[model samples]
Target: MDVYIRSVNVGRPRPGIEPRGRDTAIDKRPVASVEVRDPGPKRGGLGSGVVEDDVVARRHHGGSRQAVYAVAREELDWWAAEVGRDLHDGVFGENLTTVGLDVDAAVVGERWRVGTALLEVSGPRIPCATFAAWMGERGWVRRFTERGRTGAYLSVVQPGRISRGDPVEVVSRPAGGLTVPEVFRGLTGDLDLARRVLDAGILDDRDHATLERKVARRTPTDH
Candidate 1:
């Protein structure tokens, strides 16, 4: 499979999708192109790193560490089969829908050049309540978690424009970095895996502390 960006997506706020009637930008649609940049930090940042893309839930989404979200077309096809429906590009709220990339397997700190912009793999996207509601599938969060091919969140390195059909080149990868799925599984419930990811020192300070707490809180039965 040739690695490339299949689509670029942007979204606007829509009311009433999430519980509490909070606005959501999860229903992203394909666009011709997008300008990627760092959105600073979460909760007090400029919001979506992709220019003009809405990040309504600023407190929980979009930041320098999560400037862009990428989902593999192959994964979407697999999900379509599992859900018994056609899962289109951006259905999972991705900014870039990619082809031929095993996004879940991309190691944290791995950098890719797509079009003119440089993006670094930050981590795996964790399924949330809004995502669960959008999917409308029973036990969607748990099911998504169990499946664990949660795609990737990327941080912008060099601000530039990206478009559909742009080649995605792996420019660099850090040694000893954990793959997205490994970190996701660690943060989800596997104490051992969580510790391994933390020991790898790939996560930012905030994430590191968060994972450390999870490891400390491991139940007696968790291995």
Candidate 2:
């Protein structure tokens, strides 16, 4: 089966569930098409590489490395079945709802060409408190982390227009690189997996340092 975009989604700020009451863009809706480009970097940089997609929580979301987010339609269907609800595209705040892709298996630094844009897989989507509140399910964060299908985040390498049904072509993959699920486990406190990912050396400097600190803090004997 060919990998393709099932929907192109964007969102506007909505009333948030967080304690601080900051607005959130978790309620995304599908659009016919979207223009994608690098948003530079987080904090003082342009937000949401998908033009017009709101990234109100700029402190933790949106940046050059996280220019776009894609989640597999199959995963959504699975979650919908699990929760006994109809989970629609973009409901999880993904910019792209994809079909025929095992997003969790994608290696970090893998490149995909969708429509005219080139995107490099940068990391996995880490579930946040906003996501948990949005789901409104008990122990949603722990449940999601355990499932480990957190879809991939991409950095735009070449700007272009993307639309529903656009084919997602894997342009390249890093040899022996860590997959999205592996990275997600590491990020979610799997010290052993994190140490292995660090050995792979696919993460950028910032992420590398972050994981290093996390692992070091948990493994005192490593020092």
Superposed model 1: Cα runs more than 4 Å off: 219-223
lDDT tens digits, residue span 56-80, model 1: 9887789898899999999999989
Clashing pairs in 1: none
Per-candidate local distance difference test: 0.91, 0.91
| Model 2: residues with Cα > 4 Å off, grouped in runs | none
- The lDDT of model 2 is 0.91
RMSD of 2: 1.6
| Local error of candidate 2 at residue 169 (angstroms) | 0.6
Determine which window of 10 residues in candidate 2 has minimal summed lDDT: 14-23
